[model samples]
Target: MSDFSAEETDLMDKHEHILSRRAELLERMEAGRQPPTSHRKQQEKEAEAARHRNESLLQDLQKIEERLKGRRLPAPSLLAMETRYWASLEESIPAWEHFLLGKGPHPADSRGRSPPQRAERRASTAQDRGLPPLPKHRPAR
Candidate 1:
């Protein structure tokens, strides 16, 4: 037989209740958890995915390489095309320079003014007519 006072029995009961509550809380916390995957299994999955991506990329690369090989241009024809392109570019330079210097009017614009001058004239005309200046672009908030 054990000798205990009423207060000691009550304190022991409280201690047991606290311990049981702690254990219950711990169990509940772990109940919704999943077990961790093994490292080897996780690594194997990653390696398999990488290999699949590599194989797919390799296949695409091979197809592109084959297509390019089939479409290879003859060196002589390629050189001739490049030569013609450069020659045309060089021929246009003198006209471009003349236009830039404002020595001659552009054949496209009969007003003999460049595009920027035309825009400025339009804006001035609008202002003279008491119309609102064209809305300047504002960035969206």
Candidate 2:
């Protein structure tokens, strides 16, 4: 009461009074009827339906949690997590970097495609891949 302004406190008091009177009227009306009115019964039915819906939702949540128990992965390694974090940061940096630095009609455009393999790498392609060349076929007379 001390926290509320006088006008707000008055409004709150009136609201409480109205609610109490409404409850008393409902009780009196029920006492006069053979059975509660259809409107009251409808309200009660809707409340029960809401409770049933909440229970169904809770059951579904529990089932989903149980299903995930077997599927969830073990705790991730810190090293793998850190590598993914850095990779994602670098991944975004390059997406717009070319435009930011100005692209096209730039000096350094003349370039030639380098050979597929460097001289040192070309000689050991087979050994590096763990596969040697097959024997060549010879013609028979």
Candidate 3:
């Protein structure tokens, strides 16, 4: 048995084998013995196949990267939390406060809030002026 460790022996063997192969390849190049033939169609086919495989791998990597990015998000943003808080407040507005905001004894709609008192006043005023009632909601410009 050699004094060298198993890893060292394996590495040395691999190095020698690589060097031997390199030398043989170099010698063959120098001799120019039976110069290798070029198969253009076969090479093109192999290149196309390799490109397709690379594209497929790239798509898979992109999908995994996007999934990782999605997971990397820590939590709901401050703006989102604040928005939810305000929405809750809007929904929970008391019937008394809803009436106070308007002049008339406004009844709550299906969403539990009456239409703004200004819309009713506008429609009545428009009728008094002998004009068509203005739309409750404005059209986008």
Candidate 4:
């Protein structure tokens, strides 16, 4: 019984020594390893910076969209008004052409004479006053 007790005590001491040595080695390895907070803090800071950058980019995009909207194509009301004005001008084109061709009523000839007769009388009076006769057709350059 004494021998068995002595052997058990020796084995227990050896086990305790080995456990203490392993604990020391583990502590040294832990000390040599990088600190947990350094890498984590660096990553957290980078994420925060990225978040700020993304927020600024989003704001810039919103501003650009607003500017583009302001500078976009003409509004429907403006286009409609322009279309109405052009239509009015189109409706008046025939009157303008008649006036230019001397086919419209003359203010001085309010007796309601025919346009050709009025033009002929004016041309004859002008010729009688010694003016050169007007060309029947324009000569090509």
Q: Give candidate 4 regions above 4 Å deviation.
A: 17-35, 74-141
Quick one: best lDDT, which candidate? 4
List model 4 lDDT by residue over 1-141, tens digit each: 999999999999999999999999999999778668888899999999999999999999999999998996899999999999999999877777776798875433445677789889998999899998766996889
Candidate 1 per-residue lDDT over residues 13-93, each given as its tens digit: 999999999999998888647445676689889999999999999999999999999995779989999999999989877
RMSD of each: 13.9, 19.3, 22.3, 21.5
Kindly report which residue stretches of model 3 are placed more than 4 angstroms away from their true locations once superposed: 1-38, 72-141
lDDT of 4: 0.87
Tens digits of per-residue lDDT, candidate 2, 34-58, equal 6558978999999999999999999
Backbone clashes in model 1, listed as residue pairs? none
Better of 1 and 4 by lDDT: 4
TM-scores for candidates 1 onward, in order: 0.32, 0.34, 0.26, 0.34
Ten contiguous residues with the weakest lDDT in model 2: 104-113
Kindly provide the TM-score of model 3 when superposed on the true structure, using C-alpha atoms: 0.26
**1 or 3: which has the higher lDDT?**
1
User: TM-score rank, highest first?
Assistant: 2, 4, 1, 3
User: How much is the lDDT of residue 61 in candidate 4?
Assistant: 100
The Cα error of candidate 1 at residue 128, in Å, is 31
